[model samples]
Target chain A: MSITPFNIPIVPKLKKETIYSLARKGSRIDKRKLDQFREIKITLGAAGKAHGSALVELGHTKVLAGVKIEPGRPFSDMPDQGVLNVSAEFLPIASSEFEPGPPDENAIEVARVVDRALRESQAIDLGKLAIIPGEKVWVVWVDINVLDHDGNLFDASMLAAMAALLDAKIPQHEILEDGSVRIIGPPIEPLPVKKRVVSVTIGALGNVFLVDPSLEEEAVLDTRIMFSFDEEGNLVGMQKTGAGWLDWDKVAIAFNIARNKYTVPLRALQGAFKS
Target chain B: MSGKKPPFPLLKDGKRHDGRGPMDLRPIQMKVGILHNADGSAWVKMGRTEVIAAAYGPREPPMKAMILPDRAVIRFRYHMAPFSTDERKSPAPSRREIELSKVIREALEATILTHLFPRTVIDVFAEVIQADGGTRTAAITAASLALADAGIPMKGLIAGVAVGKVEGQLVLDIDQVEDEYGEADMPVAAIVGLRKIVLLQLNGVLKPDEFLKALSMAWEGLKRIYELERSVLGSKYKGV
Candidate 1:
């Protein structure tokens, strides 16, 4: 048995009304189009000791992702392949509504959503990471820490994680005479990343869809849907959260918007990695 | 996406491993009011998967903070018994259970009339005694019955189902083997009369068009299951 996380972000009635009415007119409080996104800024190799790290800012929301790879036992189900574990923690400093505690449903949901996208897309060549068939393998961990809370944590956190993984350097290892593997060199080889997966999150203000919503807009959303796509526009993962419902028409429109609009952020991420 | 084939064939000529067609569901059997002491109870068996669900409360909430001012807090938990599967899962809650519990709660909450019982708590528990596949959706279907049997006023009933791709052919109500070996699996729940999807989740890869087609297929399955729920509850409450 577990307790539910408290309802978040007590929003003002006037703010909700203002956001909703403007949305119905195909406008946003931030003066962006229904499908337009805010500017994204990324910084990599910032964490001192982590194998890899990246900090991404989507508008005012800030998330930092750090990658750590270690030797660990393989899961029984996939003994021949390595494991990818993703975890997200919302620091109390990130928002007044957040507190110091174990991850609640919000944290768990976002983490799982990101994990599914990466694993399902086979973004990394996990099968090549096994050191021993059933006993040991390289475990890649992507830990996303929200440093600031604005809105659309899913998109920002995902970008930070993607950048971090691309920047990661796998630790060099050697097999000893007794059959034990040892990390004998500094992290050098680039992680075996194969694909670039981007995610889009659309928030509904009634029937209107707003992409990459700000914090104020999130407080007023009836519900939000998140979708992940690979470079080729293949759908890899999807999750619809919030206690509200989406009609089939709204979903179709959102899907169309997601399929076309993912490249905006995908280009942003790719450009950041290049620079 | 169709390059690697499954070790064992999951489909042959549009027929599944168990002889179900592309759009056919597994044989479903259900019973309500099985637990006399519970305010509401139900047992559901769809193929090899079995589940029992119970609802209690609209009683005083445990903590003052949890009591809502404008709506009752509807709490739903989906748990699997230790013997539910072949591998004997531990009693402790796994990450999958924690996430599923929340997903199921949100799905069912869409239809419940929580405003009618403000400052109280309505609790529903769905325990999977046997699981092959599509446990969350089945749990939601059963829990909705339990809530209705408890006399909780809901706007509508929820019907849950899963659709998957086997051998590049779309199929309905996937079994455990197909779920494990299939290239794609998506679980969906919807309010049939309202024509609204309450819960939707997906894993594996699909083209956008394939995804859309799969959703439509899942909706059709939900409509059929929704009718079964209406008849069962009608028989219990209205003696129809």
Candidate 2:
């Protein structure tokens, strides 16, 4: 009945030393290069009942994304466009640190980051979701559930959300004589997705940087930066976390790393859609 | 009949709507240890209904009061996704879900050797990703496998099935249509090898003789499910 704060476990000193030494050798604890990612497996339509859904496993981290669309009144200011609401729940059983109850700060942050990446990059064509001028529109809700926490959740969650959106279908409807709408048929049209966005996390330890750090690596890292890129390699959003700061040079380097390797996850996501 | 015509002829020429016989269960597909983060997990599909279950623990209880001195406390959470039904459901636990969770926990607890791990809790989470009725039975079946996949000690595997009376005919494994329009529904869960029922819930109406017939039909369906569960576990843990 009570809520508790999530506590990040401390890594052993020897393991930290080993990670630092590995960084000096341009390697990682997982034996990947500085900019390499772990194996990613994605399954679309995993949530068979959702309009669109995907299960993404970035290494050991697992996240399930489900998209539901319903007819509702559009916002007063954005009457011409539909709305997108993104929420993430860290299931208590996913990890020992996560507690049961409502979404905590970490869950909210993940949801907002994924939401901003998709919204800012125009991933879904909101204008096309409009059913009427400003009175009615399809409100798309993307819910992310973290089933496992092995680190690099931001990238995994973003990929899951994107895959779910791409796999979504809009329900067929008929306008009634009273000007109300009725879903007359099953989902018939795919959601209008205009752009593809992929996020990559870069972890920094002293002067060395690494990509897709695992939970163990994250426990000892000094700082980490996440970059979201559109298909054209344009930076759409970024979030910097950890107590340490990254200089401009490091920031540019991180951006370049993301630009060059963003295709890895994007291609993986697209591959899931095709299957 | 309350002067209301039944929704379509549920049975024709001795065959049910889905071409199944009176005692034939819907096709089932099951996989164990499908999730990496959980100690044990399983995915199951029965007809059009799909459910995934994950088991965690024998670890320390999150709340001090939940710890049991003589055995591990079993906590079950059954969730039907917002999109799991024809109409979108709210992403909140409902009364139905709460009751199902309690029954599922009790059903699983009958087989799990919780006394082996004292002062701890075993968490079982079942999610109905898709529903065409009988989701609770499907979820319980999957959760049983998940607990086994988690390598928890148990006396025997548990299997579940639902039997109902539709259009005055006893049928095995009612689909969504029959669930909404049928005259009676009875879901039963039992320890597979021991043939002991741990959970049973009845709704609607049925005479004593009809109830007995439904129970026997459910037993037959559960036996087949138990075999499937064994095969799945055997194939996954062949060498170990």
Scoring only the A-chain of each prediction against the true A-chain gives TM-scores of 0.95, 0.95
Q: lDDT, candidate 1, residue B88?
A: 93
Q: How would you encode candidate 2's per-residue C-alpha lDDT over B1-240 as one tens digit per residue?
A: 111346688889999888999898899999998998999999999999999999999888887877677778788888999999998999877646755665566567667898899888888999999999889899989999999999999888888899987888989999887777676667777776876565565554455456557777888999999999999999998867
How big an interface RMSD has model 2?
Answer: 25.3
* Segments in model 2 whose C-alpha atoms lie over 4 Å from true places: A1-6, B1-240
Compute DockQ for each candidate against the true complex. Answer: 0.60, 0.01
The DockQ leader among the candidates is 1
Clash count for each candidate, listed in order shown: 0, 0
Model 2 steric clash pairs = none
Model 2 C-alpha RMSD vs. true structure (Å) is 22.2
The residue-by-residue lDDT of candidate 1 on A31-123, one tens digit each, is 999899889988998796788899999999999999999988888878878889999999898999888998877788888889988988999
Off by over 4 Å in 1: A1-9, B1-7
